[model samples]
Target chain A: MDSIEIPKRIETINSFKAQGGKVAAVLPIHYSRALFRAFDILPVEVWGPPEVEASYGGVHLQAYVCSIVHNALSFLKKGGLEIADFILVPHACDSLQGLGSILLDFVKPTQTVAPLYLPRGKRTEDKQFLADEFRALARQLSNLTGKEPGDDKLLECIEREEQADLLLADLYRNRTGLGLDNLSFYRLIRSREYLPAEQFTELAQTALEKHSARNPNGIPILLSGIVPERMEVLKAIEELGGFVVADDFACCGRRLYPKGNERDPFLRMAERIINAPPDPTRGNSIDERAEFLINLAQTYGAKGVIFYELKFCEPELFDLPNLRNSLKQAGLNSVHIEVDIKDPLSNQVITRIGAFLEILE
Target chain B: MDKIVALGIDVGSTTVKMVGVNASGDFEWNYLEGSDPRVEDQVDSFLQRFRTETGMTDSVPLVATGYGRKLVGQAEKIVTEITCHAKGVFKQLGHGGTLIDIGGQDSKVIIIGEEGQVVDFAMNDKCAAGTGRFLENTAGRLRVPLDQMGEVAIAARDEVAISSTCTVFAESEIISLIAHGVKVEPILKGLHRSLIIRVVAMVRSIGLIPPLMLSGGVVKNPAIRKMIEEESGEPVILPEQPQLMGAYGAALIAQKIAVG
Candidate 1:
């Protein structure tokens, strides 16, 4: 297969804008991309974008805020998010909740703010609460777009996202035989952050069809974290004889949603998200996350787990101790590497990963 | 030397180390020098010295390990310090156990399995508090020679509390202590205590494995060795030429390729 041509985020954003479609700037982790599409709005995720001078955002936020919020607020103040017609800040964690509050109550940017409250746990009530939250967001989106999309139209959009997610999951299932490098694979995976469901479906299908056959090398490992800010870490893992067989990153793998079973579109969307991989931000219990990860390791033949997280990410930091202990009990070794977004991957990070790979070896 | 067949180079942040091993995996010869900014040239010059001193025309496989290992363009393989140290110590000591390597800039706790595999490991964060630099920084303030710090510190029965874990701040804290007329010996002992406490925190995190082993440049410091033993209540084991373990391990890894 020829080198896969992935869509660039800037060009995609420009093309969508040129079509007179409004863009909703999405913040980390879970949100209703399908609902955004119901109002003909494109959802573009913001994950720090790395290397932004966070001075402006720093002025407003505490020194301890995670770089994602710091750089995001700074990026907004710097007008980097001017292309966004609305900013959708989901209450993924306390820091994100604070970001939403700050945007709505103060430092209000030109873009309209849409805050979505995420429910904790996998209880039936949690699903109902989230579904209700989605319905509320849809109403807000309706007011912003000045056109309330019917339930049927919303369901249609939800089905489109479900299809895209299925393909994404399939691409992961076929990752090893796909023979793509770590960087290329992640690039394709993250393309969903901005690409439309149809476009993402097309890209994912192209990748799956173009799967080249090759014997994959390196010790298979699972990655769990808030985000992979420093790309060099992945390269280090590869060069040091480690292969990422699967991941549980908030920006990538954790969002892999199975199909939902509900008559209402909002409930369906909520169910899909709640049933997706257990995430630290989602307030899933340590047991749930550990079981999911152990299963992931068993399914993928991964020998170890590497928790590659950005510093000051409270949600990830909270469950790490229990999660690591649980993994060790299951006979799957793990390592936790925390890093700052502004700095490049350090030798310390590389050494820890290299050593962990050696442990697996 | 039974004909040196493999070479290992550890281009560390503070020093460059090279080791040669024979067919039977016995260390044949070694070289050490301060780490220079131009690593490629330094390595090239070291290789030239090896050829002239050993007077061996046979080519040997070279494995490089260190933070600067990537700069060793001529190396057949680049391994990390953790693996290299574990291999070097396990090969020399002939058993698997917990190994603590306190280098100038980085500190590591590696649990070696019974078969010489790295079972688990943890390195110091970006902070220098748990490393040799932390001691050197504060020792410089107290006017203690790096070599004699351990001796002076170990002898002081009444040790002051060195509360600052930050290397730079420890200096400021030292200055404040000096102004308060605190005894130098007690303060020096406290500084050593502080460093050991930081390392012990890491050891506690992974849980201590018995027959605790020591390597790296700081292993030469007796106070650190004795204090670590005291902190963990486990006897410390030392390999010959602890400073050269990384390079020695690299050489041992290279032996496989040479024999193949």
Candidate 2:
């Protein structure tokens, strides 16, 4: 999987664009990739760059906005996304929504923008609302790409995604059994964020076949966070004799698509979103998220949990106290560390993580 | 004079603290000095001074803590100040409770469990407000000594409202208040109150336990301890030599390693 570098993925997208293919930039968290895949639009997920000297993002956005949004705004200001024909900002959180507005009003005023409204509840009305939103988004995409994808195309894309999801589930389920360390596993899985679905599935399948018996060397810990932007956290855990057996990061673990019963493509997409893992931003109760985290920890045989929250992320911060209390009541020791996307890892963070591991030991 | 069984060094933002502990983990000799820019050289000199004063060999187990802990190359183990403070306070107080350590650049409210373990903790985020530096910066502008500022704050009959929690903005606010003929005592009281309120919020965020404990260099200020007590409705427990708790805890950890 390491052989498929990011440069190659960028080149693939650039070459597709060069040949007159439309590119759409999407923010992280839940988004229907089937719509873009069916329309032949290349979807690129925007996780913030590791290091950025903010130009307009800090000046325009609120000082407290998470670095992910800031860096995305910075990327747009610097014309990094000029190649993107349009931008799709999902209704994931307030910051991204605000970023979407800024992009449309000021930065990249000429670029077409779509804001996805994801459903937060399981009611029938919620499902209908999401289905309508998906239809609207499909129309918007069709207008942009000059192709209205049929139900057959949507179903085919869904099947490809379902296959990828199942492969990902299998990979996560046997993660400890796979000899790959934490960083390597995340690097491989996170590639799906940018790489084309079919290409990602091929890589995932190839990696799955090479799985061996469980290594089980260090203490197993569960990681919950907004995103694994701080790849250094994974590296530090591995270096400090800890293995991340499971995770519930928004961009990693919780974003897994659930298999749905509906045969209609739009309805199935809505059901998948409604039935997916509990998300803090989607108004899921802390009890549900906490139970999900605890269950993941228990199933993966994790000794403790690490809550690596992005600093100033209101949704995650609001959910933290209740989540920590719930974990403690369930007799699981957890540590909370605030992360900045710009400086994902620092000596201070390393020391704190080292001490947290010592406590668990 | 007892033979040193372990050594601990805490290279903090404001000051460097080192402690030598006996086999029983009791502080036998200690050193404290303002932190120099060259941390490695400062650490090497401290080690030399310890050896010269106590005639201890270089084989003593050493642990490092605080912000500059990584700079100490001689340390056998490096731990965060959160863990070390909890260990040091719990060992001294002989109970598990909430420990709030307001350092030069940051403040932390840590919840310690029954086993002297850090159950949970929260630190001031990338800001100088509610820290020793906050008062130090404003005190410099007010032409008040750091030690005398607390006493003056305690002597105020009435408090002025300080809206800004930022250290830089608060300095400006203080200047404005002085121009408006606000007494220095009331303004000083307001500053202390503001810092305490910030610290108390952190304590509540971690769910403050009973028997709240205070450490770090800021604890030497009488007004901070008093205001924190008044605001939280809990008497603050102070460790002997509060600023050295991180090093003391590191020394205890070192002693444990040496014994093991």
Candidate 3:
């Protein structure tokens, strides 16, 4: 894809808003679409510039700073962040927290700092805490916009989001028993970035239709790692015929945040997310990550695995050494790729993926 | 003489050091890496170097510390950097001494109370801004040699304050300062002073106290060390080869275990 296509999309969205539609640019990785839609906000994702030049005076952050934050900050400096009236931030990761502070304090004073504190424990206490925090955030928003975030409205939003998630989940299930190859599956995932949720869902539905007509093909492969900052990286993987069967990442290719009950949708959403199967924290029975990967690969009948590592994401980097070891011991064919979202579409990564795919084939 | 040799290996991000204290309570240093690659190999090569240097063929009881401590396979005990730092600092300054260690990747300020218990400590592990890595990166960017950067700072006629909290921006600021007819010496002095200023904030956060022992490779920079003292308005002690403090502490623990 051309580097300008994404900005062009943003431009189109802006022009549409020029004709009197409201445009609210957002970073969709950790935020709930239900919340954004209920606020009557258009959820256009904020991304890094397609091409980046060496900026002489950018603040030197820690080596572990997330590239997404770097790219977003760069885009903000380039006046790309004018589209968002308010930005929602979650403490999903450390870099986000720092960037949120910078944006609010210096870059854009109007940007909201709705600190999303994730639940810590596995109990009703955690649920209650999340529910209360979510309610506080909703109330703060309501006060700002003078729009009551009523229980009925939240539940209605949750139900609508759940429909989209359910359809996507069903689509994943449809491909499970089909013995489809890993490479083609990744392409479908890449298409999600270019196409909206509705369009992406329809394309997935169509692809499954095509798969149903074809004969059984390659082994199931689970693609796991930190969320890709740019879709171009995944497109490279897709072109190589590797299927990204499932992921445990927080970004794209996951369900939109689920909703709670009418009286307490945040609580319900927290519960659903907490109970989501194959959780990154404790999905595999084994404590050792290598054994976990090996067992997961074997149990899932995955012939190959691809780990997409985000540069500056310390937790992922720390986990990687062991994960790679386990994959090697399992005799599973695996490739580990390092990516920074700001410099996502490098020929170096593309060549590496091409070589790895050729070797696997 | 008993062939009891206890070795402390500290594999830090910037440099690695190992010390061997024999059964006689005399400590002999062996195995030091300065900007060396093949760290694991360096460790093994150092072991051989130790054997050759001391002419001792004894089984070395091992304790390892630092970021890569987990990779030191021969360590009988591996301790966290905080504990190792406290032990090392306490030994040097006695009890009730504060500790400031700036490693390549992280900076930590530790306080030891009476009876050598950890009173409180603060760590800035989230960034390399106040760490040795920041200095190293800035030096590279300025095209100034590592050994001369400190001396250059010491020669400053008038110190220019650096306002950037980040190393990347600081590098640009340094370049711009030099470009805008500023003398090189004062800019370097200012850079060192800036690091001290940043580190002092962290020290103040955890409550600074004296007889503070400066530990880590950065302590070698006397100009920076003086700047730290000036910033804190207190004289600070330094360990002999301060970078090896963590590893030495680990070795001390191993010695205790061997003796007991």
Candidate 4:
């Protein structure tokens, strides 16, 4: 199969601008459809980067501060982000609030603050308060855009997005059953950004439809890693006759959205994404990562699991001790792969992964 | 007479320290700064040193402490640094002493009762804010030897306050201060004070009390000690070579086990 070439989105941004598209960029992860599509008029997120030279960490904040926020700020310092006409800042985490404040100071975007006030529902009035808040936010957006989004348009957009999501959810479901090989698994994750949500959904569905026709005679392997920036490493695993059917990485499998209740899609989507399995420990706390692998091995008839740890990523390193212990105790066939993103395309790592999978089978 | 001995080794990222205490609460021997790489190999060497240094190696029970305690061979008991440090501090200060231990890679503030048991503790393992690593980094940036930072900090006529909370940022801030004609003395003083503030925050989180016993290698720096006292509003009880306190505590635990 030939590799798919991703069209440059920069040219598309110009067309989007000419079409008077409202652009906004998302914060932290900065991976959002609304923000990306709003190319000309709005940037999804705006936040000041942390001073990298600061060694002690924030004196006021706890040491367990998320490094992702720091990375976002670092990228901003390097002018890596696209400028937006407006941005929506949400109080997602403590760092997000700090990033919002920093973004407000520097980015000079038409700032729209999204305060996620999760109500405990202790009192009936609290639930009412939340509903009122949500309505107010919608009203605020409507006022800012100067286009009162009718119920029909909103519902239509929701349905379209939901369809895309259902296809994605189906991909996850199929992968869960067939046990994706490490290489193909990572390739699929990388394939997501290259195609639009709808197109990606179609591709996934097509792939699943043809899964039975495709060769499944490979060693079943669980591909685990901290955010794998490069897709080739996963492909190398596939080339070695090992199929990665399961994973625990946050940047890939876990980040994909599954279909949610359309009656209240946005809120349900947010809830599902929030409730999605985070890494079991600090860093990538896939609490059920080991369990997921074991279950997949039993269900998909996997022979081994390959755990990938990124270099200098302490959170993953700390989790590995317990993860390795659990896998050993479970008597699950597994191998640990430590990957340094700096040496991403290393043949040495590929050879090791191949040898381990070969031995297990 | 046959002698009983128990060994306690604390393997830190930068250094390996071990102490052996006999059944009678006597210091049989002590070994510090073993070979790098696998610490299990170092333990074997330490055991050999125990016999060479003290001329007695008859069935000494071993208890391991610190991060690499589990990796050490045949540790009869594996205890956490929090427990060991608390026990060592308790034996020295005898209860109601807040322990401030700033080691190579991490910093910890432990509050203990009279029994030397940990009541509450807070640690900064993720960042080098309050740890010795911060000072090491800051000294390197300042081009001042770490051993000299203590004296330099103490000599400052006016302290140059640094606002950056991060140690990496603090070094640049220190350099900029120097470029702006700030005296080295005050800048160093400020740096030490910044570290003290970070540790003090952890101490406050764990709850502060009087008669603080400062432990860990960072205690070797008197300037840091003074700043900790000034910031904490209570003088720290100086343990002799506080870096050895954790090892000493492990030794004490070994002694208790051997005697029993």
Candidate 5:
């Protein structure tokens, strides 16, 4: 099967809704998609539109809100999300939490909005809290779909998602052997964010089987960031003869979970979220996250690291200085570039990346 | 006569600066001019003047830096102001520490390592209040000549606090202060304080390292320099020509490349 285009994905969701399937619009990073799938609901991930003219969202949100939240609110204001049966906002960041309240109180007061509060700490109580939250979310999903998912159905969904996760892991393990450039690799993996679990698995399996042996033949670098929105950054890195051998983006590479065999599906998902990669906002210390990135760089033989920070992201901003110091101590060169989702990569940014590549060379 | 080994151009937001460095990386000659709306024309005119005055050939490697650096088609390489400023200041001061560059459009606090590499940096984001343009806007409102702002601000007996750190809001605040009969000198002093506070916050965010250095066009203001020293609590070291540091750094890079 050909890799699904964005419009095709949207069309598929719309057709599903037309055939009486409910669709839930999800905000970025950390939500249980298996529950949505088991309930026969399509979970469509929203990372804000590529272009945004924020008229209504600005009125509701602060000027300093990150563009992802602003653009998402803009999408709601413009009725772009009318096709979504309900909107699910995860407690991913301050911006998304605030967005959930805004949607609940003002923007879409009558719309069905579910907020999943994923526990941020690692205490014993935190585990119970997350498991309880997932159970609550499952109840909400059950209520929305008017169908309590049986154990068999939930297990089936979990198995499919786990298979997809393994396929993604395999792809990342053999990324260099796949012969796909940075942009193509990200585009392929990110398809899972929107595609149904089974379809995404098929895509990943096909991609893995067709792996080429050609090396990227470029200076390898580890890309660390929140999300890979600016495709131009990856393209520019390739043009500068640098290859992103590994990544720690919240939405893409860091989200994969190892195989878990817990009987209770909700507990399994909760365990997966807690054990996933170290994220700044998700209660991971700077040292832990920095060490994680350093190890990845070392494992991949990456010469340097590129921190693609999203503008106004307080969590990432707070972690950057210490991370840089740690990376340097680990004998790696690193550069940071602040990016906005709405703006394309400027020449100034491209020039900086080029110079960084030259330094690595 | 010193032979020009490489050339550097800084097409900044408010001004265009160019420099030619000798083979030994000493500054040979330089040019500074207000940025024109047509940057390509300005670059061509500047190059023509350089050729006519110094008889330099076009074969010298040219490196560009600044916001408008990409428009300089003649450049063999384009570098960001952050890296270039670090290189230039390290060369000038012969050591690395924290370098604060307040430019026409933006302000940056860059931490340079012992080897003159940019270890880390923080810049004012999508806001011009912490930059030279902040003071320039208020200077125009108060009818104080840009060059005289520093002297006027220093003469203030009692400084008034200008609260807004935004350029547009600060202009309105200035109007209000003038309407309330506040003296221009105190308002100017307050404006300098406001800008310095913002810049210092950035400096602290990156964690200040000494010896603190200052560069960019804004360093010409004695009030800015004094207030920065007073606020940051560090003696400010400056390049001989702070405004040309970006271009000078670019020239240095070009020299290294040519030699290699």
Candidate 6:
């Protein structure tokens, strides 16, 4: 993700901390950025940093744990997150839930750890359940920080994040025309993980301004998975005569939250996360995920879906076969490729992506 | 005889194949040899020999395919073995169908469209169980020569089950079977069966489109074709030269630009 000098994670964290702002080391998938900001905490997410030596995390975790959880714990054990004032672990999947349990029950680090439970369905009661959970987290933050922001302050923060997300959605809407390569586009998208909403909005707008009719003529494909970890994958895709036109990756497109209409801040946040795109991690059905993927592919003119996934991720892996079958039945071709974040991008992966693109060609 | 005007070389893990096509893109000349560790040097020597023998001093468009395609410095283009194999077989067979290419390093089942384009495909990832190496490793372990593995396997009346799908683990299993006094023929049959089962599973995943053709150096083994037919219940087809499809396809792609 280049040509745009997007602020580094370390720089963002230090800047926030220097401003007397507390940093929350958030784990993957969903969390309330507005709520965290309301309590003077900056939520910078950790998606395995993926390159860490996982031995420290391996000491506490079972051998089967996904590298994201292992690397997060390993990174923490190695003092990677010592500066954070809080750690937020969302129950996005069983592995992440286990990570939260391990942190609370055993490898208790110094940061205040909180686990957020996301609602499975988009039903009214589901939204209410997630709202209540966020409310409880708000109470936890209030106790931990001894500073309670009023509804007005909370709403102000929500408005800022919503504005930033609106810009994110705009970026997605006009992604192809932006002339951003897979790596650069993803870099801009994932900058949301650490950069404050206001800052992300500025960079996103600048990217949109540099838009051109020079959208790459490469075979358009959709990427669906927990995360796109390796930079080589993007480079490999481009080199192979293809580019990601759409994504269902947990770290990027899946987190494109729509604006919530509720007046209550927590309910608004819950509405956004619960009503975001259909995802397997939230226990969404194969039919729902497949239908969404079909629509996504059609909307973006993607020839097929590449289920690029991480190894040992049960949620994504569990839904893979059925989801792939459903897509095939609908006349959408799909392929599954797994990667261990601890390892470098292998030639096999490049060849798989290469062959898939060749098929689409 | 037509004059050679285009070139394609497939630098596979176990072997290197370079095929020359005439102006109309029919295979006019070809070369095959064990893969050398120094692929660039190997390719250079191959090109030098081609120039000396063919007597066509002018350079033609060259397209490289396979794992070591990138190492071929003289190539004007590089295409993946998947596409090259599909294109090669489609032209040779006179129709589109599911084509399985089981190389020494990896295996792929590609669904070919009517126009010789790849429609859909599946590949075994980072594993040798579904590939030629699976049988090659076991052939050495069973003390059977690589070329005779098929004949020895086909003659066996009883095929003992080999439980391990991993190439390395299958070697250990073969040892255990031999220690238990299992006949080498049956063990060889079991290994072939193991490989076919894995490849067929990949074929089924892509929902095999028939005419069910085979390619790659591994398909040179007669038993692989017969067993694939048995396992898939679909007749398996073969081109004139199964091992040269990748290079042939690459040559065809180069031919369009070379003579046009």
What are the per-residue Cα lDDT tens digits for candidate 6 across A1-361?
A: 2357799999999998898889889999888999999999999999998789889999888989889999999999999989888889999988899999999989899988999998888899999999999999999889878889998999999999999999998888887888888888888898999999999999988988887778576999999998888867987888888888889998888888898899988899899898888888777898898889999999999998999999999989888888998998888887788898888999888887887877777
Lowest summed lDDT across 10 adjacent residues in model 6 chain A is found at: A1-10
Cα misplacement distance, residue A205 of candidate 6 (Å): 2.9
Question: lDDT for each of the candidates?
Answer: 0.89, 0.86, 0.64, 0.62, 0.85, 0.89
RMSD of 6: 2.3
Per-model TM against the reference: 0.96, 0.94, 0.50, 0.48, 0.91, 0.94
What tens-digit string does per-residue lDDT give for candidate 5 at B1-260?
59988888999999999998988899999999999988889988988988987987757888998888878988998888878888888998899999999999988888888988887777774688988999999999999999999999989888999888679999999999999999899999999999999999989977898999999999999999899999999999998999999999999999998777
State the lDDT of candidate 2 residue by residue for A1-361, as single tens digits: 2222333657878877887778888886777888788888888888876466665688788889998998888877777778788789988898888887887777754678888877777899998898899899999998988898889889998888888888888889988766787788888888888777787888787777776775667889999888877687788888887899989889888878888778899988888878888997777999999899889989999989888988889989988888888999998988888888887487667766776787787
**Interface RMSD for all numbered candidates:** 1.3, 2.0, 19.8, 17.9, 3.1, 1.6
Instruction: Identify the runs in model 4 with alpha carbons over 4 angstroms from their true place.
Output: A1-121, A126-361, B1-4, B24-26, B141-145
**Candidate 3 positional error at B21, Å:** 57
Clashing residue pairs found in predicted model 5: none
| Candidate 1 per-residue lDDT over residues B148-229, each given as its tens digit | 9999999998999988868888899999999999988999888888888888889888878887999999887899999998
Candidate 2's displacement at residue B145, Å, is 2.2
- TM-score of chain A in every predicted structure: 0.98, 0.95, 0.76, 0.66, 0.95, 0.98
Measured with C-alpha atoms, the lDDT of residue B169 in candidate 4 is 88
Q: Model 5, residue B161: what's the lDDT?
A: 91
Instruction: Pick out the ten consecutive residues of candidate 5 chain B with the lowest summed lDDT.
Output: B117-126
Q: Higher-DockQ candidate among 3 and 5?
A: 5
- Per-residue accuracy of model 3 over B214-246 as CA lDDT, tens digit each: 888888777878888888988888876677777
Model 2 stretches with alpha carbons more than 4 Å out: A1-8, A18-20, A49-53, A58-60, A104-108, A212-217
Q: What's the CA RMSD for each of the models? A: 1.9, 2.4, 14.8, 13.0, 2.9, 2.3
What's the lDDT for candidate 4? 0.62
Off by over 4 Å in 3: A1-24, A47-57, A175-212, A215-220, A238-241, A253-263, A277-300, A326-333, A344-361, B1-260
What does DockQ give for each predicted structure?
Answer: 0.68, 0.49, 0.01, 0.02, 0.32, 0.60
What does candidate 5's lDDT look like per residue over A111-185, in tens digits? 589898878787767767877887887888777778898778887888888888989888889888887878888
Query: Which one wins on TM-score?
Result: 1
Using DockQ as the measure, which candidate wins?
Answer: 1
Model 6 scores a C-alpha lDDT of 0.89
